[model samples]
Target: MLNIEKTFDQITAMGPVHLKIFTYIMQMLRDKYDVSMIDFDIEKSIFFYGIDSLKIIEIHSALEARLNCKIPTEAFFQANTFKGMIDDIVKSISNDGNLGIETSHYSLETEIQEALDYLLRDRPQRDEGYQTELTHTTLLTGASGFVGTFFLKELLENTDLKIFCLVRAADEAAGLERIRKTERKYNAHLPQGWEDRVQIVIGDMSKKRLGLTDEVYQEYAKTIDSVYHVAAVDNFYLPYNIIKKTNVVGTVEVADFALEGKIKPFYHVSSCAVSLLEQCSDPPTIIGLVNGYAQTKYVTEQIILRIAEKGLPWSSFRLGYLYTLGISDVDLDPNVSFKKLLQLVAKAYDKVEDDFFIEADAFENFLMAIPEIGCVPDLDANFDLMPVEYGAKAIIKTSLLPMSELKSCYTFYNPCPLDWSDIVNYFKQSNKRIEKVPLNTFVDKYAEYVRHTDDNSIKLLKSVVSSQLDQQLNTMFRQIDTDMVKEDIHWCPPCEKQFTHAYVDFVLND
Candidate 1:
């Protein structure tokens, strides 16, 4: 039904083992649930399709019987997508009886050390007299990526500098085509005759000389004014080596590039999710970061700090999660952009405008149910959501300002985070059929439904649970010191109701 393993020699990104299991599971889904394999999204909940509770129960039993192993019901609830289910299966089998995350075999500390060595070794004599002056040219990595494309557009609109894009392509023509596709795909409105001012360098971050010949690379070094490092592997589940090679080693390479010739100010887009000290004035560390992506980001920051110690002035933006609503359809490309990464969590929006909207499993239904069962007192935790467009503009504008002015306040997140309980009454007032059950009752229902759930029965339960925990624990909640950064262009926060409506509209229409 869904065996791509035999035909997957052509698909190198997915290894044979994964390909085999995935093909098997997808085939089972098709055969047992009447699911179509065409254009199947691995990140979407099966409930988003026509699959209901009865089919899910049948599928779960069928899979267990066929595989001759215990497949946890929680996995179906937690790993909502088919791809995630495959990963869950792999992890479960690999762990045997153990129930913890898979750890990387390689030394992550070694990966961090290599970045420091690259920046410090065979060091180019510093351009000690280099002054931060008006920009004439700028080098940017990840121009074809989601945030990169937006940042690229920002640079074009705001500055007079000629932009040099470091793109991974076979040749200049290919690079241009890639750029064209990325811009159109993201609806990046490039100004007319924008091509003249932009130059494309065909290169790979993981390779030597940025995958450029020594001669061409040197020519590039001589022409650049600044560096914007935004490209990265954002997958949380990817292996440590893949993350380290790009986020750590590739960072070292970029830092090296910035130092040679006219030493330029390096703009590194880091993440706020990096473990912060319990207090505001505490040192930044990577202790609490759970995934490889966050860990690598932490190491990359450490590398940048080391390079700065070597006399290169740099600016690091501690970016927050981008908003995942009301964007053009082109934003949801298969690549791990903000939109795609947030897909599973956004399933509530996906069902809001459906014909069965009242019958769907929804986020608010769970929240509304929380108080009745007293699982936890009404949670007032802040859950701010910043629109990507506003955040991108703020980031680009802030990056261009003098570091001293904005360095301390380089954070970009919801100026106002949402509180779950605060919004519940509003939903109730609307007289919608968002049922409220006791928390324990809801849990029992969830247990029953994962076996055979349909009718919008909390498809994003895992995400909802995580969010609830985050709120209850105030785990990562920290005040946004927006005053530390200059706001050249003010951001008007969307009203939560209006904001949600727009997102719901996009999901239904799409």
Candidate 2:
């Protein structure tokens, strides 16, 4: 039989540094989640143990303090597996004689290109066995996410198909509970007897075959009629290598599943950020992008396009910022730059008397901060905000179109987007204390204001401030070309009409 203690003893024999790092990780797992090191799979994602982005941040901070050296946050994220993370920690420790930045020979662009080439090879052919329409069953990934909850709602309410929700959980009961939690959180209405129409398939997208067994995987591959892949790690700060396993590799796996069964129509939810990158670069270099989230999304879209070329009926919906329909605080992506900025602004304004920043309504903090600071950053960008409900419905309706009429790409963004000045104007009318200032001026003011408080929130505020100063981020929300999408899908509802105070109250009041 296998002995975990013996293996751990062997590890401890390597070196004191290795022993310390390994011990901390093992202890953290045990103390926090009641998980033992032996039960942890070295090859699986750290998220498998319920480590979220916030937890990763906390872990990195503690490791940095213990090791007495700087560790890149991206390094932790880039480590897709537990073993990869431990290895990276050791390498960081070993090279800390000078305590300088760690350099690597890895190239992100080359990695993207190679992964794409590998996926394109031996493309699946459409035989006579292919089904022409989505009739009976469909497979949906990211059914528990913000926009995904809406996707689940749309499919259940509008279609007669049974859905196989690919969720990461310990078992079927756990997966179903996860979906129920999402439905409650997002206020998604589930029809009576809805459980009969939905099946929870416990799986991880970051793994091969989506962490499914051979028999079960093959069964779903043969039975599922279509695919909706919306699940992704949306952290903006993590680098490409870290997010590649889920965003890029998971996409490839989903495509593989789609092609394996009777050829299915693959509806991919892409990002408008890709369009922003393309417009900014004469010829975009994947490595030159500002964040890993955009890089992985770019690569995933290319993969979908290649699959479309190989006879799979695929459609990509390039969505912008997906806002809440009513403001129950469920549609927002926590990692999105816009939400982070709002939170930081809120913290800066709500400098509490304690050692930590008190949590307050982010929208309220943002609105209040403008008047106190007397200036808003002249971002000079239009927000292509789309309501979650509309985006979800649009994806479903467009995907259900006749295969021959299906366009390879459809852009979903506000046809009439609101400029930064528009939002400021609403607040200015209520409180004349605010005015538009240059970006640099706003950053300096924000930083100086945040410097007054020596707390944990200060670090996050500084990071967000520094990110705002990045030149690329300023252009991240450029006008997305939606003429083709509008013309192709004539019956599709408009994404948004105009930026109004009523709309402001709808989002900020809660």
Top candidate by TM-score: 2
| Per-candidate clashes, comma-separated | 11, 1
lDDT of 2 by residue, 1-510 (tens): 244566466567766776788788777768876776665566677889888766665566566656655555555765667766776777656744332123322343565567667655664543445678988999999987777888988898879999999999888898888887776655556666888999999988888888999899989988899999999887554556667789988988888788774677889999866754454342233232345677677778877876677676887888876654423223234344543434533443343234322243323344445555678777655655556766776788788888999888888766666566667677767667777778788776765554443333332333344434334533545554663334323222232323345456534453
TM-score of each: 0.64, 0.69
State the displacement of the C-alpha of residue 185, model 1, in Å, after optimal TM-score superposition.
Answer: 3.2
Q: Residue-wise lDDT of candidate 1 within 367-440, one digit each (tens)?
A: 44433333432345455455555666777777777755545325666665555454444444443554544444
What are the lDDT scores of the predictions, listed in order?
0.58, 0.66
Q: Candidate 2's C-alpha lDDT?
A: 0.66
| 443: Cα error in model 1, Å | 9.0
Could you tell me the lDDT of residue 302 within candidate 1? 67
TM accuracy, model 2: 0.69
Q: Please give the lDDT score for candidate 1.
A: 0.58
